[model samples]
Target chain A: MKKSIILFIALLGLASVAYANESQIWGEMRIQNILGYGQEESLKLGVLFTMLQSKYFAWVFLGVLLGVPLVFFLHYKIVGPKVFPHSHKKHYAFNLFHRTVHQIAAVSFLVLLPTGFIIVFGDFFGGGTLVRMAKNLHGLFTIPFAIVVIPMALMWLKEALFNLEDVKWFMILGGYLSKEKQIINATQFNAGQKMWYWVAILGGITMILSGAFMFFLDFKMEMLHNITGLSQIDLLRVAAILHNVMGFAVVALFITHVYMSMFAIKGAVYSIITGYVEEEEVKILHNAWYKKLKEKGKF
Target chain B: MSNEMSRMKFFCDDHRCIECFACSVACAEAHELPTGISRRKVITLFDGIEGKEVSTSIACMHCTDAPCEQVCPVDCFYIREDGIVLHDKEKCIGCGYCLYACPFGAPQFPRDGAFGAKGAMDKCTMCAGGPLETNSEKERHLYGQNRIAEGKVPMCAAVCSTNALLVGDAESVSTIYRKRVAGRGKGA
Candidate 1:
């Protein structure tokens, strides 16, 4: 009996030691603890911040900030009377669908960029009031931006697929930077633009899949959820990284594509915005389609 | 509440715990842990003779003063009345500081992300409720184990087939442990 009591005291001493050195378990349990706290406050704060950074607002700002001068320069310097001296006319099929896609893409990209930046940089910069504000807006705008881009991807799926023509155009560097007036039978969209389209579609899908997995953490397919074993917050943390990386990559691609379409290519802007291009310019750039349309008296 | 202590503690008889993973399975089931995350793990530390191996089951000790609570940026970890250190999953950022802070490497992260986002910090919580209101679905989904609410002993202690793992009030548990150690001619 005395021996049993001594053993009991030793066990009690060990238990006390475990309690005293609780910090040893610090590495094991911190993330789940933080997640529990975030669910109470940060998540709601982040969603709210996401709304203020909506693509619609960002696009409108971009239009006022950058589009005004771009439109003026393109209209006056490139496609103005001094350049080609022809009146503009609209192409029904190309004008409507192309313009709509442009607008949608512009808005989606604008919101996606800044919101994405915040998600990536918020931790590095410290989640201050401004960072918190930006996070909320980033989360909010992702919803509509994702919605518009999905259908846009489906709508343009046909032209974006890889083909032999794309290879030739890629080999020739899309004939934009070079002074070569290389005439090739081109389709509705050029090779460079087609490449950009594919990048945007594929990258956007990656972001959406990763993002959706994060957003509906509680509602995902049981098998997948069971396999992941990640908390919703953990998935969001990962999605935030992917979304930011893809968002910036897409934005960079957009900047180059936009610069090419509006500035580098002389008649491209007019064709997209005013829905028209001079018949001669079309014949030079899109020889095969131009010939087909002219034979039908459609150009 | 601060003065209250846990009724269950895990004690591994160093002689009997042969480094097998049976305790891990019992823990996973009791907690309903997803496949990739194990709350309890047996770690073997072999030293001395070539033929001899020493292994111990390392898990959350349900510390009375848990360090996980201190290092958490969001303050999500909480010590239950029973001294189990549980945490909320909603606030986790997957930053992985807890892994560094743990001495026994009890915290395990799933290698799921491309850039190595530490999947939520999952560790033994002594089968106690987390930050969620006890017995809620949110608690079940996030924290996994909730044995304390069910009025049962932790599964790791109960299912240890070798009777190597023991759980109960700290005092009673120590008494049993002391007797076993002395009977085996071991020192404190």
Candidate 2:
């Protein structure tokens, strides 16, 4: 009888323990190990994010900030502005459709760059309501900025393609630094402009891909990473680096492009604004394009 | 002075944990933490599988190389001489970058405001509060009890009935854990 009682108690204890474990599991269903997120991904994200918070990024930001004006100053001091001889004859430099697209692209870029910079350097300004506003605006502008770049790239595709003449133009530094009017044979867009177009197109695509992933983080990208033989963390690190590096490089190129169009070349800004350039200006600057226009009797 | 230089650590022996969740409750009650935030949580993996059920209580590991400190955008986190990682609440912008950076998901943000507004981060301080006057009411209110300042164990560690959670200098904690595992006929 004593042996039987001991056995019954042991069986009862085991049953109660199992039942308690089941209840415990049901109670803590929401709690998870590492909260169901990959620890390595967080570590990599932390490391990169810390890097952005460091003084290195600040110094690089300062360099890019000050470098643009210095380049412009040197150009102004050494080369002086390009002042074409006056001509009353007007030529259709840009059509209404192209000019409209250019204006929209310029406006969107103008909004995106400042807001983007504010978010990037939020610590210096002491992040608060303004930084939050900048972040939202940056996200909002990305849509229009991304949408406009694709159509604009397609529209200017033919003229933006590089040819043998572009090599000559690049060798002479696009004739901007020359004392005399050294004409390098070029079409509607110069070699420098062609390079800028390509950078903008490629960089825009990169930004969109990375930004979309960051925005919609719920995507099952880990499965894709598994198939590709890369850990999720590795993929995230690569994406983050590409997005940031490409974004900064394209921003630098943009500043130079703006300075060239607005300050260095006198008629360039007016041409974009009014959709017209002087006939003599085109003949002197874009000789190849002018000859082609004449041959077609479109001038 | 040597104790100050000593690296502090926390260890949870799964063999001893009963999954009672008293550690989590004790921590919350001791800290007076808001309802939505939990400083410690007990997670049971593969429960009700006869021999496979494993329970462990987790909080901030106070990592030797902490990811939270690395990822804070405002440079809010600071590590003490004893390796206790803490952060300044005033500087924290509630951007949730630290949440992404932490491997243990130790960082907690209170969703008190509308549209799911995230309040500043709150985490396990190892019973050490923020950069405030130690044991003051302000410190207690913002960061919870500073048991470490009083030369006492953390409340969660203190109230653990099973003694699963152990906290101390690295050498001592490891020694205790090593002996316990040995008693159970397991490799340390």
Candidate 3:
């Protein structure tokens, strides 16, 4: 913390020297008259400034700090410490291929998010060395991330689709904050899980597209300009904006998804790791899918 | 805003420019810039045309609210009192956000290390250099000439044989531009 303060002071001093060379009076008039701080310019500055200085994100963190506890207190008040009783019996929930795909996706997301943040918010992470390293690693991980996204989307597409049963699951809050055991007739995934899947799939696709547009196509900007009616500048601007928006959404979803899997749900993380769940646990949670398996003589 | 210093702007007279490339050469020579980086360039709108080709020496326009400054995630860029948008190379991540953000394609990058990775962004500082001390060796190495600090016109504008490139206060430059256009009776 002391080091950070010292670094901050040094950087500010350096900046002041750069700025002080010019007349103080001219700067103000130039901003008001020549620069014309238009709405687009204002938004760009606002977004980039927030990323650099973290002033806006400080408020976001404060909201998260206050909101998370409020949510926890509400959940505690409503649901208390209710845990389902289950016997020690195992049943197949995920196949080997599904587990493999999930593992790849999980690892990629974990690596990509932090690296991406470091590159985008380079000011907070220190000088060019760390930022360059983060940028390189972020580029490298994007390849695996892009490859995994396609397979993961295909692997979970059918299970993630919304159905009439999902409506009932939503009505009961997916049995999340209920003291009574509301029998949610969900298949392999509940409404909440399905939502997570879709967000990851769609958001991941957007990130891949925008990232690809930024990385490879930049060199061929002239060709792109001829092919597309829009100028290369406009395309790049749109890509940057899209990349930022999708990045924020994906990160938010990933945090909540990880928290729910590891802490909120019992045996959930275990099931993902082992590719199996207790038969009694499946009977209570995924009763619809369990009944189908039983009728098929597979359970 | 004040009598001491005025908001500066750069203008290139299209009619007077002859696509000589002298301004570009003068800028590179004066700055002693790296081989790959050209801060100023003579851009021809049409090539191999009889009396239809229009060319102008272009560089950073030193925009009032520069998009490069606005979009830089590391906040490396800063506009001076004279509206000369300068950037700190120390703070720059070389992510090319400025390149993408700039409408004029002003930002230049040099390949560094093995496999030609992008090192840092180099652009027309408008002869103002960077955040370093005025006319310092470090400033010269990173940001080229500091002629603006020394109260001299930019090398590109200075060496233009036809007096095409003009660099001064925006008000004075516009007044000159208006007279030149009115004399010709056609806007360039």
Per-residue C-alpha lDDT of model 1 across residues B64-180, encoded as one tens digit per residue: 545445544344566666566676655554434344333344555554433323455677777776777888888877777578778887778777777778777777778888888
Tell me the TM-score of model 1.
Answer: 0.46
Evaluation by lDDT, superior candidate among 2 and 3? 2
Backbone clash numbers for all candidates listed: 25, 0, 0
- Model 2 C-alpha lDDT per residue in residues A93-176, reported as the tens digit of each score: 688878887888788789878876776676666765666566556666776666566668878999999999889888888888
Taking chain A of model 1 alone, its TM-score versus the true chain A equals: 0.61
Where does model 3 exceed 4 Å of error?
A1-82, A85-87, A221-228, B1-5, B32-36, B46-52, B111-117
In model 2, the runs with Cα more than 4 Å from the true position are A1-55, A85-87, A216-219, A222-235, A278-281, B1-4, B18-57, B94-123, B127-161, B185-187
**Candidate 2 displacement at residue B179 in angstroms:** 3.3
Least well predicted 10-residue stretch by lDDT in candidate 2 chain A = A18-27
Q: Give the top-scoring candidate (DockQ).
A: 2
> Model 1, residue B130: displacement in angstroms?
20
Span of 10 residues, lowest total lDDT, candidate 3 chain B: B109-118
User: What value of lDDT does candidate 3 attain over all alpha carbons?
Assistant: 0.70
- What C-alpha lDDT, on a 0 to 100 scale, does residue A269 get in candidate 1? 64
**Segments of candidate 1 deviating more than 4 angstroms:** A1-90, A93-98, A123-126, A223-245, B1-188
Candidate 1 predicts chain B with a TM-score of 0.83
The DockQ value obtained for model 3 is 0.18
True contacts kept of each: 0.00, 0.21, 0.32
